[model samples]
Target chain A: MRQSRFGPKVAVAFSLALCWVLPIAAQVETEEWRFRPQLGLWFGPVTPVPGTHLTRILETSLGGGLFFRMNIPSNNLRFETGASYSYYTSPTIARLHSIPVYGALSYILPIHLPLTFQAKGGFGSNFLRNYPEGSRNWLPLGYLGFEASFPAGKVVNIGLRIDYYFVYEQHLRPPPNNPNYRLYNGHFLNFGLMVNFNLNR
Target chain B: MVKLRNILSFGALAVLGCTNELPLSDLLNNTMTLKLLGTYESNDPYGWLNLPVDDVITTSGVASSDPAIGGGSDLVNYVLNASTGLSVRPNDLKFYIDIAEIRIARGQGKAPGQPIPEYWSQFAISRQLLCSDYATAEPGRILQNCADQNGSSKLHEFFNGGFTYPAVDIEHGNYNHLGIYFRRFVTAPAVGFLGNGTFINATAPERTMVATFDNRSVYGMDVASLLQNNYGEAAAEPRMFPLQRKDLKLFVEAGHEPYVLEVRVFVKNNMMVHILQPAGGNAAVTYVAPIDWNTNHAYRDLFNGERQGGSLLMTARTYQPAKSGAIQFSAPATAGEYFGVTEAATMLTTPNMVLPLAATRGTNTRITNLPPGNYNVYRLCDKTRCSNASTPGGCDQAAGQDGYPETVAFCGQYTVSSGTTTNVPLALCSSACP
Candidate 1:
């Protein structure tokens, strides 16, 4: 039988709605909803597209991100989102800065222990700034990472994360008739320390 | 659990390795400098010889052998006043320098005589009047006025201060040679005296003859035949000094150390010569008098009619009937009568180089951020001239034609090292075509 393009989306949305409704119904009977507000320090190295003038102008430097999340009962999954900033040092003029907004789905491991592991996958839109004025680009990005967390107390969890980012292919417009212009696909790696507050507890 | 621990250890190592604390390559330390020392000598020992003025001739009154006929007094001293002829001096004169490839002298995978590829490899520098003081004046007026107002000086002193190339990154190695070329317009004065009864005055309409000293033209036949067989002389050639020095070695370093390479070049000015006069019987005396603003001080004695000395004697002066008996300074019947009267040969003396030119005193240029290495230095004639066998109707034999030949006159070898200053001294030939 043939299926409509929206059919899968509708089913996935219905399942997500049922999962949230069931968790809410159970929370009403059990007496609480689960939410985690996280604060983190993110840092890593970022490389620009190679074989372009931008590579010569920009170099790998440290950058960071901060995030917040809300837990769902079904499969121990959570909705996660964050804002991040990265920097690239320049030798000629000014430094380059990249700020991105990220959204992701995260799942905690089912291991029965005081310490837990989590995995996340997300998409982001990055806005690069502070380059040669009037030369800026918006990069569509993807993220994947792993985190290990341990409960410090009933209300807080301390975690460490290693995130890898992939920026989609893009091109920088060069002056007319210049043969040096090239397409860029950037890769960045970040490490962070997170402090999560269990608001529902 | 053990596998997870191993993965974490590898990840940690990779993160540490990707950190940005690694050092960047240190290419900023390479540099080379070519400085002008303003000290040079002439290859010819007996340099420029002064020719006599046009008016001094052998008549029944003043014989050629007379001590007072063509001696030191024959050189007329005119103070180049406002009304002097406009054509008595060259309009513009400049120096051109060229450097061949700089390469590693001795190293693995390094070849000799191969120059480093650089966009700034070939460039030119000129000596021109940049100040506004003489902006509106003619070249002759400017030169005369500057010399008169600023005391005796060289042309470069009143014009260009010095030349400095922008910073360049060169490879580290032993260099083969650096090439240098020079060109200028020399003005030879043909002055004489006109006389009315009992009154003698410097003549009008003094001829300022212009000559070019181009090394390429000196060896044009040699270079042209190399390019093509049966090639004719070029129709038009640039006014350039006919001297070149080539194949100088310079060494460059690969560190941030500073180096200063000074190139001392000597120019021969055709303005230094001696004039003789008969003091008494059978003995002619010459004085060591250089032109008003020249730096050469070498002197020559003209006696017994040797080296065309007989034609350089002065015969006429402001008529003083009581002291000197001359009714009038008669004009010469033929131009050849005054063989060496008006022309003077100028040379760069050893003493002048030791004492710097007064006008260009205390001028130095500092160039930073150049790659250090060995370079070959050369000097040659860089001018534009037409070929003799150029296609008819396709090429014109004008003075500034394209596809002109270049000639090398002087070539030598020197070395440049990092963190150390290298001085290269060179001498110009006294004769224009030597």
Candidate 2:
């Protein structure tokens, strides 16, 4: 009598999208959409939180990633699609090397003067390699980020990005009675310099 | 407005990420802890060594080698002559205990067929458990409930814990005999010292000889009397280590009531390796001797021809080794560890020259090709003892170290005759390093 997990997850996602649309539609601007290809780099530290097998033994590790993004700017709204390569390491066990390909939406804050702040959120699947016991799982990934950037030049902008990523991982056929082998969520946070190259320039 | 939306979105993701429960870490607490102590005694049935001849050394520092006229030339005779010391405890012993059943008898039965009352029944303790209820499962009951995860291979990591589940609260009445049924697989990192540091001119001051026991027949013993006993862990096959009354005690914690029955068992010299010589080979020509004992169990060396190298230190620069007398010995294979040897020289003309010698199993590693002089072999080790404090290798005696720290024992020393091959056979012993 096992039920499918797909239906409930889809229902919850649709509800979240509806909540987002009402407020976003009120501030929609009629500016023409402009497309730009960009390249970015980020580095930060990651830690396993409570409810993980490695929670007690795993040490904090510094991680880094690089991404190529396509940005379609329309007034206050910006649509982005990107593919990234992230790498992380632990002292005892585990090497988390993943490739996350995602589509995201960003909203520019209506603040005065020099610096511009953008709120970004995305959902995608992350393919991980070198997992514990050689487990290769493509985990569902979601991230929320905040970026503050100032124009470095007409062609490029140098800014700092803080992104928190969550990945859902499934157990690899463990003994059914032991709850210790259940599904867990892998978490990561990145805070580093992000330099974007505006392809239009 | 943007900051509020960002906070709400991040909070929702955080909730989704942290919804699962933490896995239990105390799964090992359910298994019983069986501590193995080594008791060395003459005429012990579990004894692996043939005999211990500690008092029969000649004044010349060589073991008296009487030629085999009729029933004499054997591994025990050859290897015993080269042994420095014997002990019950080895440097390391790791084995898997796949227990099937444990039964205790309340009465002393004269004949093997005499039936004794079961102790568990008298205490009203439940002996049967469901496989799904693994949280309270005893180590012996694992095979009864769950499928063997290692599958045919009984080699699995021993779960380390203090809590012995199926806690025995019953009193020790007339229960004098305890029988345990289990599957057999034991791995001992065999280490021994060869020469005494006494005679530097003829033999090494101390020489360490190291080997490993990947030999299944050498370490695997028949645990049960049942047919097809070697194949799997079944109730029909049972190996029993009868515990004496003195070894059984009633242990009660200081503030606790109801005395608990504690059974202490001693595993004898299971690591003792008997070195035997083949019957047809010429005593003088055949330098490589076959190592085994005549017993019910067959001994087969797995890692033959494995090359082992050790460092040799000469004690004195007096007698230089002549390019004539060769030291022929066999070094068994040890995987995943280091081997080292140091020797003191009483007759070396060169001052403190540390030479490297390699020994291979079933073959000869010639050291006679080196410069001629009297050389004293000092020490040999499976793991090198580093002199530098900063280097993170070798077993350290520092408090709270990772593993058990051990000292390298000095093997025996003997005078060497020129133009002859000296066979320094290695023996596995209970005591070492003194």
lDDT of each: 0.35, 0.35
Number of the top candidate by DockQ? 1
Give DockQ per model, in order. Answer: 0.03, 0.01
What is the lDDT, from 0 to 100, of the residue B219 in candidate 2?
Answer: 20
TM-score of every model versus the real structure: 0.31, 0.32
Candidate 2 chain A: worst-modelled 10 consecutive residues by lDDT: A171-180
TM-score result, candidate 1: 0.31
Off by over 4 Å in 1: A1-20, A23-32, A41-58, A90-94, A130-134, A169-176, B1-434
Candidate 2 lDDT at B148 equals 28
Q: For residues B1-434, could you state the per-residue lDDT of candidate 1 as single tens digits?
A: 99999998755433232221111111111123433322221111112223211122222222233433332222333311123211122222222122222212222222455643221133123222111122211343343332333312233431232233323333444454333333222222322222211102224222211222222111001111111111122323211121222222345544333343433333222122222333334432222111211111111112321122111101100111111110011121111111010001222221121211111111111111122333222222213233222232222332321111122322133333445443433242112112
Residues B1-434 of candidate 2 have per-residue lDDT tens digits of 99999998765544333322222211111111222122111011122323212211222422222233122222233323444332222322333233433444444433455433323222212222111111111233334332323321222111110112242222323444444333332222222212221122224211222111111122222221211222122333222322122212122222111122322222222133322122332231111111111111111111211110111011100111232355543443222111222233322111112222211111222223212333343222222212212112221222211111122323344334566665454442112321
Error of 1 at B135 (Å): 54
